[model samples]
Target chain A: MTTAKRDTYTPETLLSVAVRVFNERGYDGTSMEHLSKAAGISKSSIYHHVSGKEELLRRAVSRALDGLFAILEEEHACAGRSVDRLEHVVRRMVEVLIAELPHVTLLLRVRGNTETERWALERRRDFDHRVAELLKAAAADGDVRGDVEVRLATRLVFGMINSIVEWYRPEARGASDREVADAVVRLVFSGLRQG
Target chain B: MTTAKRDTYTPETLLSVAVRVFNERGYDGTSMEHLSKAAGISKSSIYHHVSGKEELLRRAVSRALDGLFAILEEEHACAGRSVDRLEHVVRRMVEVLIAELPHVTLLLRVRGNTETERWALERRRDFDHRVAELLKAAAADGDVRGDVEVRLATRLVFGMINSIVEWYRPEARGASDREVADAVVRLVFSGLRQG
Candidate 1:
């Protein structure tokens, strides 16, 4: 009710709260009223920061996509032999996903319900195709297995990576991000079987 | 509605429609009215088969859980060398996931909202624990790498396997169920790298 309390919420802090609510209630289920309640601010105060829930979603998913797309532009991802470059991208992906867990979680769950959601899906497909092309190049280089179809391998590897968002908790005294990235890279390239 | 139209919905057929709607709208978002409309029956007609929407969720998750648990009970999973047994379970997990795609899809998306959802989450944990134990046995046998923690490895492997539900479409011409099962087994055991 106080102006001081209402004015304390920066857009970043508000976005963090909005993303959590969206993740919990689902974007479609979450309303501006829910955001206001969760953020402990007036609905008008929330509108002061962003236009609506869709804008928050756009911000969140764009952040996730940017992190992922940035990996492909990195030096390691670009300069190595196709398989090594693919491995670099995979390792960077785990790091990016863990770093941006809540945002990426929201990104992965968008089911094309709204225009923003559909745009997120389209960007996601573009990211997938970029990685799939990397897998194809690796296969053509005879560095990765050619027996498995490139598209299927790409999807399965992505499945392994993206599933990290489901259970990973940074605050939990579990594996460090480095340990996880190493494990994912090893499992993706070397299998679980002992060498 | 005509009597014949209402009478045509068996519990099995009604459950199918309910699950499809549940997957599309999500379990929490879906209501009895939604199920009734999706099934082309009255809400009372739905109640004739089961108690409510939660019952449909219970039934769907139970079906998915039943398929996964059945994999661990198979002879190959029980009697082989620890690594080989783990491999069998991984392959069968992919198969069960594909065979019961909608059921498992709904199962994976449950967020412990209601008693039924919480129960499903518990059962999923129990299933994960069972698979983790198999991975531990394999690591102890030296058939699989020991550098990665047993629990972490089990999760990543399951992540790779369980993700099949996200994108696998049996009706699609891309890969047969057999091809997918084979690809999963190969990736889990041998990895994406060529020898």
Candidate 2:
């Protein structure tokens, strides 16, 4: 992905580099010197682009949170039966996750030790609760199974979707985003046993 | 859980404190000082039990990997039809994850920066491949759906299962291990759509 020739480092470009290192070394583990080395820029130049490492973290997570929150506002997310709407959100989440892979990966790994991390975590919870409500609505409508609690099911479904960040490499010969998303929706609704 | 009266810090007890700190602060970010502080022992005293910070990480991941690999040896995991065996493994994975919550959480988060972390990542991949083969066998039997690639399906299911580390608080008012396992099996094999 980095093969495209680039001459200058924008704050956004610097953030992309910083996010990768943060993911490699934990956010708390990454230092300005590390970011400077990864981005091939000096420490002073990095300060010129963003306030510091915390600002970069805030930007990266904001990008991820924006992607997730946008899914809730889409026409498909709002205009269908609760189950169908939930399915739309799930499928879109996979697409968004892959598209914004690194940012989402960092978002999932945040521990609330710092102020920025705490904020990111709070936003993540709100997104989760929103998804949980959709599941609860589907269960109440009897369009989805009631035997499994909606809250637990929501977390597992998110778990399955989010785990893609750990394993999905864009260059690898894995299934397309849509294919993985379909499997998730199917597995979430059906039993593994052969009929 | 820690509310129970405790006496002295054995290597095992010190390890429990270390793992929690590792999870809270990423492994790379944690210092011997942090471990000492969390363990309530002086740095020199902590060394009396274990070698160093690396020792704690190594011990924690070993415990988690042992639990997972042990499941493959169970009679049910070995003797049943491929699909059933796969189901057995999947169900047991949830149980083991919940049973060794902190250890497994630390295992999943390893990034391979250090030698010990590299070993953990390699073993994690081996365990994943073993589960993938069971999934492949089931797909061959036309037991599990062939629509999704087995590798991707295996990852998504593992993603769902491994995600328990993120939120499966043993003390939380959450679903039982069996409940979570049943939901995973249902989601992995059948899916979310109503019959």
Candidate 3:
């Protein structure tokens, strides 16, 4: 009986395994049996750690959403001139996306299949809207171009920033997070065209 | 039975149905049964048009890839100065992506789960490399900023162009494709910052 003792899986540990499987197989493709097999536990054992597969998804996306929303509250993101604040938010978004890559990857790939995914999507839209407001303010202040529609500008900028999750590999590149952030900021502000 | 033969499905029609289903249920989550129901045909009838689900995926992605590759081969794309060529490519990409919105959407969503998906992914990488070469040429010519790596710039710009498929609704917005392309080109060449 004493030898049977193993480190009990916590929600966080179990979530890590589930997110990996989800990312690999996609959420709809993954089943509880798959999670149990990957976690080296029984289906019943998984229930003890989390309610079900959707809970794992919810938890993962919540972590990514928290990291993103935190950026909006940061001093530089809130206190600077509108364009500068927008730049701060953009750079921070790239950093957070890379830092929470897997979770954010899952968040990005959610297709609104379940209630949890729908909620995640709604929160994501809110985040986008909040950032769009910054762009609008910057435009009103004559910092950003007013000729372009505010919504269009926000979506394109977010597209550039969000796409970082698709190809950025922090472990292999040897590029520091700051380096990635700096590159994103420079490209977004000045674009590819030379002055 | 003869009535069912009134209008036989062509490979192109079948692909439209399959891509719709693939977009609805992530490709891995879709089955032959689902495709049959969506196409209003028997599973055997489905195979008569294409070998299987993978073939449908291959055809759809191929159509999208062909459109993209063709853009690079255009006289304008090939004959202009490096920066001008890059600009034309970007604008044309937005147009092609919009024109082939459904196919490109499916192409973007492929996760390399099958042999066909993997092939599609490889071809997509080849397309990216081709564009990156143009970016490199522009940077070398001093027409584009050299501060960001050509690879990163290519990805970000492609990201901006590709993200169009996610939110663009031609029917709802009453917006023509040319209008959208014009907006994208302006936004890309002119940064959000006001001059």
Comparing only chain B with the true structure, the TM-scores of all models are 0.97, 0.94, 0.94
Q: For residues B157-186, could you state the per-residue lDDT of candidate 2 as single tens digits?
A: 888898888778878777888888888777
Which one is best on lDDT?
A: 1
Clashes of each: 0, 15, 0
Give the 10-residue window scoring lowest on summed lDDT in candidate 1 chain A.
Answer: A1-10
Candidate 3 lDDT, tens digit per residue, A49-86?
A: 78999999999999999999999999999897989999
lDDT of each: 0.91, 0.86, 0.85
* 2 against 3, candidate with superior lDDT: 2
Give the Å error, residue A53, model 3: 2.7
Of the candidates numbered 1 and 3, which has the greater TM-score value? Answer: 1
Ranking by lDDT: 1, 2, 3
DockQ of each: 0.80, 0.62, 0.58
Model 2 docking category = medium
For every candidate, give the share of true A-B contacts it also has: 0.75, 0.82, 0.50
lDDT of 2 by residue, A35-100 (tens): 988987789988887889999999999999999999999999999899989988988899999999
CA deviation > 4 Å runs, candidate 1:
none
TM-score of chain A taken by itself, candidate 1: 0.98
Least accurate 10 contiguous residues by lDDT in model 3 chain A: A1-10
